[model samples]
Target: MRAYLALLEELERRRRGNSLAVYKPYDRQAEFHAAGATNRERLFMAGNQLGKTRAGGAEWAMHLTGRYPDWWVGKVFDQPVRLWAAGVTGEGTRDNPQRVLVGPPQQQGEWGTGMIPADAIADTVMGRGAPGALDSVVVRWGGGGDVQAGESVLSFKSYEKGREKWQGETLHGVWFDEEPPLDIYSEGLTRTNATDGITIVTFTPLLGMSDVVLRFLSAEAIQGLGSSPPQGGVAA
Candidate 1:
């Protein structure tokens, strides 16, 4: 327990090194607190600029690397962890975990408060550019030892094109950055194969009724609701 707490503090310190400021102090604190909890699912519902994505990114990094504190509730995949980091479109992925997953030390402003551990990335990982077809790019990460970029087993795909590939491969985890089609999430979760793999969904709510949103709110899933709809008007 003591070691886990120490590791958690170290992660917090590294997270704070980012250039962006926390938009909501209370919310930021809440996320940090929740980040340490052992719960498999966490929801951060708040207005924009409240650091929800950043919180998710930080936790995702921990999951990717299997460095989560021992006391944390989140599941840690067996290394080499196969991961799927997606967005509504391929373009949106460039700024989020696409970079952070294999980013440099001086975390860019574009990554916002989310920064990857510079030492953890491999040259081969970055060199593996997005395959012309979204399904072509495979990505993976290592923990407890060094992982070469060429060795990244994880793949990057969009909601539209990778269904076949997603269905074929076994994965360690999935991180959906923005709301993805409900069917994609459903199919993707199955790919993780429960060999004790995990799936994480992070995004600001949009159009209120997306299938992914409904699944996140489902009683059987790792539920969360975060948004800043106009006062008196319900979110779509």
Candidate 2:
């Protein structure tokens, strides 16, 4: 009885640890993160339920909070950042990136049970149309000498809103939850151009030979970025 009770306590603590504290990605995921050190844009193409989306969410959390695990060998930001996380539609955005980053959109009580640590979430702006969708989340960034220096903002968007919505702000990073339209992909790249920020696209190559797909798999891209894995992997 005593040992069982202690086990339950350990589980509860891990439940709140969140993001990098608990994200132990497989070999493919780690290679993807490591590639971020030199590459500004990367693509992780994989099959469904292979932990690709979770890895993306975990990396973003580390960037927002500037809290990298000891094993982390990826890009690190020294200050608070403004980033965008998007999908093909509002609902898709909510279900994938939003769900992994902030928890279940449909469950209000479980909002903090995601890659972002519960205590690190400072505030959240609810989305306008979709039920329980989030517009943005303010994360408590800790890179500054003081914890109160400033907070990072993670805005949610959908490609369905078009390239116009993607214009304006200079972002620190952008996470494309899935493969996006070539035009939408271009706009996302533009948003991060000024800041020299990173772009992460995690998706399955359903649209075979598409422009976005070609961009990552082309020989030119292979030479520019590092090598991809044998199985489903990353093209930096």
Quick one: best lDDT, which candidate? 2
| Superposed Cα deviation of residue 225, candidate 1 (Å) | 11
Tell me the tens digit of each residue's lDDT in model 2 across 53-143. 9999999999988888999988988889999999999999999999999998999778878898887899999999789999999999884
Taking all chains together, each candidate's TM-score versus the true structure is: 0.60, 0.89
Over 4 Å off, model 2? 1-14, 17-19, 143-148, 220-231
Residue 81 in candidate 2, Cα distance off native in Å: 0.6
Clashes of 2: 0
Indicate the residue-level lDDT of 92 in model 2: 97
Q: What TM-score does candidate 2 reach?
A: 0.89
lDDT of 2: 0.87
lDDT of each candidate versus the true structure: 0.51, 0.87
| Residue pairs in collision within model 2 | none
lDDT of 1: 0.51
Error of 2 at 110 (Å): 0.8
